[model samples]
Target chain A: AQSVTQPDIHITVSEGASLELRCNYSYGATPYLFWYVQSPGQGLQLLLKYFSGDTLVQGIKGFEAEFKRSQSSFNLRKPSVHWSDAAEYFCAVVVSAGKSTFGDGTTLTVKP
Target chain B: GAGVSQSPRYKVAKRGQDVALRCDPISGHVSLFWYQQALGQGPEFLTYFQNEAQLDKSGLPSDRFFAERPEGSVSTLKIQRTQQEDSAVYLCASSSGLAGGTHTSTDTQYFGPGTRLTVL
Candidate 1:
């Protein structure tokens, strides 16, 4: 079965440091990819998405993701992390219409 | 504009009980979806609805799970005789539909605050 994987279960980074969260998917064909963030007691919010064309896509909250077809990965990156950036980040893929499969998610903790 | 809203932000039920969770999608949204998110995990697709028609339900785990979107505005997910394994957060999402009630994979999905269901 097709699945999405996020290698890092938990990551701790100091405020103002650079951040990268990895995501990999196992699918026969290239599918629509997305990154979402969820704060405590909140729903999942779309941070960025990559459908086609440009490999690098920018999203809200100063976040960006690059889709690498060769590696089947779409990793999220931030030039500088903020204290409020500490939350759970999820990587999802849409292999079919109206359906999404998400990874286990990576929990980010910002240190002062 | 109001985002998707779900009722009963939290629910606790006995092992053999049944429960219904409601979701109110954004106005004029043509697509609706239901997902199950367990603790420490991402949301898993459960069902999909195109307007008043249920286009896909292959993600539902078992027969005990059922979802309905009547009038193309509000949706409800019902779990029958819930089990201990049924404890999870139920998420609802909506996306703008294309003309003729069709939607593609690229549409951004707006999610609602999930309803946490705990079965003891």
Candidate 2:
């Protein structure tokens, strides 16, 4: 079965520190990858996506993700962490036009 | 420009009761999707619609769940005989369908605030 995995359930980082969230997937073929962030009581917001070109994709709010086909991984990265960045991050993959598979999600907590 | 919107931000339903959630996508958005999000979990695909046509509903958990986009602009998700396990946040998203070929997944999906459902 196709599945997306976010190994870390929760992560903590000091404010202004670099951050990385890992995401891996098991699929028959290389699928479109996406990163999303959700704050309390807010809907999921698209951070970045990797379709075909560019292994590294930049997204809103100073976020970027690198898609490694050989590793079947699409990891998200940020240069610095902010208190407002404390939220849930999800990784999703879609093989076709619809029906996206999502990881369980990782919650980030920014510390002072 | 306004973003996607969902009605009844919160719904409390008794077990066995039926409920319907509404979603209004951005104007001219041709692709719409529904997802179910449990507490602390990522959103799971529930269904997808292109224009008024429901292209894929294989992600729907059961027959009790149904979704429709009659005019290709607004959509509704209905649950029959709700159960305690059915409690979750329902999210609706929309994307411009201008991506040609199988590149539909390349479009960015704009999500609504979502409707939190509580089953009593």
Regions of candidate 2 where Cα sits further than 4 Å from its true position:
B98-100
Writing each residue's lDDT as its tens digit, candidate 1 over B1-120 gives 799999899999999999999999999998899999998899999999889899899989999999998788899999999999999999999998642222458889999999999999
Residues A12-101, model 1: lDDT tens digits: 999999999999999888788999999998989999998889999999999999999999999999999999999999999987776899
Docking class of 2: medium
Fnat for the candidates in order = 0.71, 0.71
Model 2: which residue pairs collide? none
Q: What pairs collide in candidate 1? A: none
- What DockQ does each prediction reach against the true complex? 0.63, 0.66
